[model samples]
Target chain A: MLYFILRRILMLVPVVIGLTVIMFAIARILPGDPVALAAGPNATPAEIEALSHEFGLDQPIWTQYFHYVGGLLHGDLGTSLLTRRPVAADIAAYLPATLELVCAAMLIAVAIGIPLGLATAVWRNRWPDYLSQVVAIGAISMPRFFLGLLLQLCFAMWLMWLPLGGRLPIIVIPPPTVTGFLTIDTLLAGDLHAFTMALRHLAMPAIAMSLSPLATIMRMMRASTIEVMGQDYVMTARALGLPRGKIILKYVARNAVSATLTVIGLYFGWLLGGTVLVETVFDWPGLGLYATKAIVSQDMMPVIGVALVIGLLFVLANLVIDLLYGVINPKVRYS
Target chain B: MTGPLLSIRDLHLTMTSFDGAAHVLNGIDLTVQRGEIWGLVGESGCGKSLTGLSISRLVPTPPATYRKGEIRFEGRDILKLPLREMQDLRGKRIGMIFQDPTTNLNPAYRVGEQLIDVALAAASHDPSVLGCPPGAGRRERRRAARRLAGEMLERVGIPDAGARLDNYPHEFSGGMRQRVLIAMALIGRPDLLIADEPTTALDVSVQAQILKLLKGTVADHDIGVILITHNLGVVAETCSHVAVMYAGNIVESGPVSNVIESPAHPYTRALMAAIPTKASKRGTLKGLGGTVPNLITPPPGCRFAPRCPLAIPACTAALPGAVDLGADHRAACIRLEALEHV
Candidate 1:
């Protein structure tokens, strides 16, 4: 098993490097003049040169890549054009809110999606199966923007049972040091006022972002469970006279988890992309919003920084998934 | 002593498809007396597996629907029983040993837990996850299940049954798993044990061990056993009674010696001749000539008529009913009477 896992870990190097190259190319090609945007349209010629020198944008592409990487090692992300603060600190403040929201949404997605998928697979022709299938299909096909609006209106406007957007109320003082995001810090301090407000604010957007991925997870899980149910081991379970439920839980679930892990990991990485639209719609302050602003304003350093961070996250997520194969599937061994 | 444990009369099944319906089993008749080992022999896609599945109520329908049949187990008509009753009967009275040891047990569970569960399920009417049924209660049931599982495992030649109970399916060897399956089957102490091609997926050497284990286990329980396989040698060694199925129909059935030495039906003879034996080195193995006929459009009279070398026009006139030649021997072929007097 150790041998197999070692092989998997070694295999990730080429994959991460390839992804890094692609992200680099994408950052360069996206329409933006970081120097001009940072200095502003009305800045004098010398001011723009000074800003370009400060960002090291005046260097050749390869030099810039190395210089940025050097800056990355020191935890410097240049200055945010909008906030005039270091991009790393800005991202540190913003990354966690998006992280919390995505995590919450993914939790809900997995909880609802996996069971629905299993239900559909087991009761292949029953009403529950058909209903789940229909709902998942609609969720998958519906545009995320429209669904976000619908969720917001129902949960935020009419029911008013939950807060629709924002991290928390202004009266709620964030911790002395905002390490990741204010919500987590507030919750850590056991500040109920702030924690409840943050949670309520996160609900609609989290639920909204979860819909499409939930459908995706459901489809994958359903197919995997159906495929596994026919395996010889399951038949063995049947011939052994195990109860129908135990057979499903023990035999079917174990075999299904390995396949499910890869899908979940891929979706987790993809969630970062979906977060942009979700965060905008809900007015949630997170990396997605920062990314969008940075991209639109041609703020090269921040845009590149976000891409690198997102790319790194994607790599790390996939690596975790690859490692998980060892745990879920006995056949997968890391040396 | 007198009556058979399981008797099937006029067992017919048809499989429906988008194009048409295919007749699978046709007026089949079989009986397994107590403590006897009966082997049903057939090639792949023959109704051999479907027959076994029917006994276990595992056969899929929508495609398959029984036309008419009376599957009498003990004295009750199992086919007529309610589904819940049938479920009750399954692990208790009609334990099945499936083909492919690797696939026969749930891979995720420890061998011990599954074995114990089957044992408990078979020994009692009520079901419980960890304990004995309500009347039996939880603690007693778990103990009984664990004890029986240990005993049965030991009987089937597994070493250290107590220690190995926690080990999952993948931990055991293929041969060991089959032994585990046999233990599961006989743990219920059912009147009849149905082992469907138990050694089909095993190594030739492992096949012998499994067959020996099964035969010994059946004898110990004095349970009538129905062993389904394509291997004539397996039947010759393990079965007292042999039934040769062609397509879905049983063409010949009698004492194993009679069926193997002088098969009455053409298809049965073809099947025996097809087996490669040590005695017949060169072309002793004469493979069946024609492909199986499409079951959807099985010939009017006999499904095997198209494949039989001795087939004539009269053979296809109608499906052959069982031709009893006396002394508990029967063959279903249009030419059986003309071809033999024994």
Candidate 2:
């Protein structure tokens, strides 16, 4: 197991290098000049030249790439032209909020999706199955941004049940930054009111982001469970007269969940970086929002940084999934 | 406790699909006693496996409906038992092994964990077996069950049983895995074991070993077994009694020797002739002509009439009753006396 993990981590070296290349290329290829964008239209050519020289933008593309790689080795992500702060530092500030939001969304997706999937499979062709199919299809078909808007209208505007958007209300003082996750920070500080507010603020955006992954998980789980249920082991379990619940939970679900877990892992990594629309709709201060602002202002460094981080996150999520497979299925040997 | 281990009387099962209701089991009767192994021999789609599933009430409903039957396990009508009561009887009082060892043991779990689960279940029904105290904690009971599981694996001839417990089902070879399944079924020490083609997926050499293991284990446990198989040779070697089924009906059933040596029913005789023996020359093996009749609209009388060369008009008029031939042998054929001329 240790060897497997080590090998997986070692394999990431090439992937990370490839990601850096792609991130660097994407930023360089986009039409527009970071120096020119930083210097307003009123600035003279001389001023633009000085700005370009100051940021090393005047160097050859290859030279700039080597310099970027050297700086990346030292954890220096360059400066965001718009924020006038280190790109890494800006990412550090925005990343935690995105992590919290994505984690919450995943929690919702798994907690609801798995049971719903199991229910649909066990009671296949019944009303529960039909209803779940409808729900899953509807959830998958609806666009995330559109779902976010609808949720905001129904729950935030019309019903006044949840907060409209953002990470917290302006009135409540923010919790101390312990884990950089507001809910966790608030709970650590023993501030119930702040934690409750944090959850309320989190509910809508997370739901919007979760719907598609939830549907994907539900469908995958349902299909996997149906297939596993037909297995001879499950029949043996039934013939042995293992209780219905035990048979479903241990024999059926344990085998069925492996495929769903893989889907969940892929979705988890995607959600971390792909929540641009949900974050935009909710006005949440996360990496997606930061990336969006950076793109609009043509701030290339942060864009590159965000892409690199998202790529790294995807790799890490898959590693975690591979490790989890060894735990869930004994047949999966590390060797 | 005084009655036979299991008895099925007039069992009629019909499976309703979009096409129509197919009469899967037509008025079947079977009796199994302690320490006796009964082989139910038939071709595919002949309802032998379904009969085994019906005994355990494992057949899925909606698609399968019991038209009429009484499955009495230990003098109690299991078909009439409440769902909860039926569950209690399963695994604890009645155990089962299935075909395709590759698919029968769950791939995700260790072989020992699966065995321990059955052990725990059996222990729950009767605490004295595992020697759990009156108020044993969960951990204590688990330890006991684990020990029992290892012991059971050793009993089934798995070498290094203690170490092998951690191995997953995929790690074991086909025959070894079948032995593991047999261990699991017998760990519960159920009175009846339903083995549905347990050795079908194994190699020819391994098939004999698995059958021997099954026979030996059931003998030691003193449990009745319903061995469902398509191979007549396996039945003759391993079973004390045999039932020949064709198109959802048992055509002939009696002492294995009596049935094998002198088959009264024409279908059974035809089946025996189909088997290639040392005396039978190449290309001389007689194959039973015609396909198994479709159960949806089965013929009015004897199901094998269409395929029976000796079939007469009287055979199609009504289903034949079982005619006793001595030595506890019975065959459902009106032309039993006419077989002497052939």
In order, candidate lDDTs are 0.79, 0.90
- Residues B31-74 of candidate 1 have per-residue lDDT tens digits of 98977899998888889888887887777777889999878887
Q: What's the lDDT for residue A328 in model 1?
A: 67
Can you give the lDDT of residue B151 in candidate 2? Answer: 90
Give the per-residue lDDT digits (tens) of candidate 2, residues A126-177.
9889988998899999999999999999999999999999998999999889
> Residue by residue across A1-335, what tens digits does model 1's lDDT show?
56654665666556545655565677578776766777777999899898778766677777876665677668786677666788898888778878888788888999988887777888888888888888988998988778888988898899888877787767777664555555677767878787778778877888888888899888888899999998876765565456788778767876776788888888888887668888999888988999999878777566766766776677677878888776666544455
Give candidate 2's error at residue B12 in angstroms.
Answer: 1.4
lDDT of 1: 0.79
Calculate DockQ per candidate and list them. Answer: 0.46, 0.74
Model 1 iRMS: 2.4
Error of 1 at A74 (Å): 3.9
> lDDT tens digits, residues B1-342, model 2?
488889999899999988899999999989899988999999999999999988888888978999898899988998888898888888888889899899889899888888888888878788875888879999999899889888988988999999999998889999999999988988888889899998889999999998899889777888899999999999999999999998889989999999999999999999898999898888886798899999999998999899889989999999999999999799999999899799
Candidate 1 residue spans exceeding 4 A from truth: A1-32, A78-82, A175-187, A333-335, B123-144, B276-284, B305-314
